[model samples]
Target: MLPFVEYAAKGEHTASIIWLHGLGDSGEGFLPIAQELKLPDDLGVRFIFPHAPEQAVTINGGMVMRAWYDIKSLDLDNRADESGVKASAKAVEALIQAELDKGIAGERIILAGFSQGGVIALHLAPRLAFKVGGVMALSTYMCAPQKLVDEAVQPDLNIFMAHGSHDPVVSMSAGQLARDTLQHQGYQVSWQDYPMEHQVCYEELVAIREWLMATLS
Candidate 1:
């Protein structure tokens, strides 16, 4: 299992939300967001923030950082290395299985990510053997999109995608392309765009809270 920081549910622990952070960030980085969410106590939602292993990202002068996959180039089509994505997906699957072993149904678990982390969430959920509650992909794009049709297992996935209109790291168009790809593949995608940058804003959090309630209820 990946090393993770967990915010345990306050009540019966009926559901789980495994959230992934962006490149160069540790699990601790997003712990505050979970707390800020202030999800209702009755929901029993546990948040798991996992740390990506340290790696030398090629685009960043090969300097080692926490990355889900290597960004070999800025080109969206070739950014994420296939092997790295699969390896991280396998690791994330183990985390999901751990939740399952603890008696939480797969459908009660929501997979979410930001930026590079979103890349993993988007890539792994459809390929999973079982269905998850939903996927929250923020400011991210698809990886190996051309192969998604042949490799996908869950065709009825619930996907919520949000991107900043002014995002420079991951352009809004890149995010749109992802939404378009998923929609073309017949997956249900809810798209939202904010007038902000690469980071999340207060408005987005409010929307996320509402979505979480709807998804986990």
Candidate 2:
């Protein structure tokens, strides 16, 4: 089971958002973003933030860390965490199901994340059995670009990806690659680049709010 930090809007549940956070951070880390979005007062959108399991990070040389999966190496040039990819995918699947149990339909829900969380959102959004409202990936990249076409388990789902040009952690190329891959697969994609680092900017937040209002309204 996955541990989660939840924020429910006032009134009945009309929609829901499942947010995932990056590595080394807890689910609570992204709660402030949810609050900032100020989901429509009457829309009743619930935000769910799930914390990844704690385990030794191979990418960090087996250092005990709170990671979605294990990284085999830290070399940015050769960084691909296979274990982390699979584990996080499974956790996302479970979270989706949990939301379903709460009566939220797939298309009424949104999956979003930042950095590492963004990676998971991109990886799993396409594989969900039911179509989701949309996906928002901030300052992140797809873990394995090559497998996206084959492993995807759902139909076309709108995707919004934003990355900082000066991101020192996950290169801007990663986000570009994800956009190219998804577009090549005929998926609806909205890609944006900012003049910042490995973090979200106010402009990006504004773009996100606009996208959410347009897509989920």
Candidate 3:
């Protein structure tokens, strides 16, 4: 199993959020964000943050880092390492199964990620055997939209995608394109944008918090 950190629910674990970090980051990367969320104690939502496996990233000059996939180029379409991505998807699938093994219903679990992590979340969420609670993608682009329709058991699974207006790393256009693609292909998606660049902001966090409440309520 991939290494992970957990934030226990106030009482029993009635729901869970398996969150992934951006490239070169680990499980601890998003712990502060989860803490800052300070979800109501009654929600009984456990948060699981998983560390991406370390691999050589091509865009980073083959420097080894904790990345969901190796980025081959800056181009959104050609950048993804498909093989590595599928592998990590399998790893994440195991995490989901682990949650199920512990008794959380598939619909009570969510998949969220930032940047490269978001790419994987969008990739695997729809294809799972059970319809997951939701998908949250931040500052990331979608991959292989062509395959999603054919593979998805629940094409309309709720999705929340947010991006920065001035993001140089992933580009706002990429996020917009992803939202359009998902919407056009019949997915329920909520879109948001901010004035920042390639990072989360307070406003985005507020929206996310609200989304979480609505999802778990």
RMSD of each: 0.7, 1.6, 1.0
Q: Candidates 1 and 2: which is better by lDDT?
A: 1
Give lDDT tens digits, candidate 2, residues 1-217. 6889899777988788888888788888888988887668777788999888888876676788677766575454346576667778887888888878988888888999888788888888887778889999988877778888898877588999999999998889878988898898889999899999988889988999899888878
Candidate 1 structure quality by residue, lDDT tens digits, 1-217:
7999999899999999999999999899989998899899999999999999999999999999999988989988898998999999999999999999999999999999999889999999999999999999999998988899899999798899999999999999999999998999999998899999999999899889989999998
Off by over 4 Å in 1: none
Model 3 agreement with the true structure over 35-71: per-residue lDDT tens digits: 8998998888999999998888888899999999988
Per-candidate TM-scores read 0.98, 0.94, 0.97
Which candidate achieves the best lDDT against the true structure?
Answer: 1
**Candidate 2: misplaced stretches above 4 Å?**
74-78
Candidates sorted on TM-score, descending: 1, 3, 2
Which pairs of residues clash in candidate 2, taking residues 3 or more apart in a chain or in different chains? 59-71, 69-84, 127-153
Runs with alpha carbons beyond 4 Å of true place in candidate 3: none
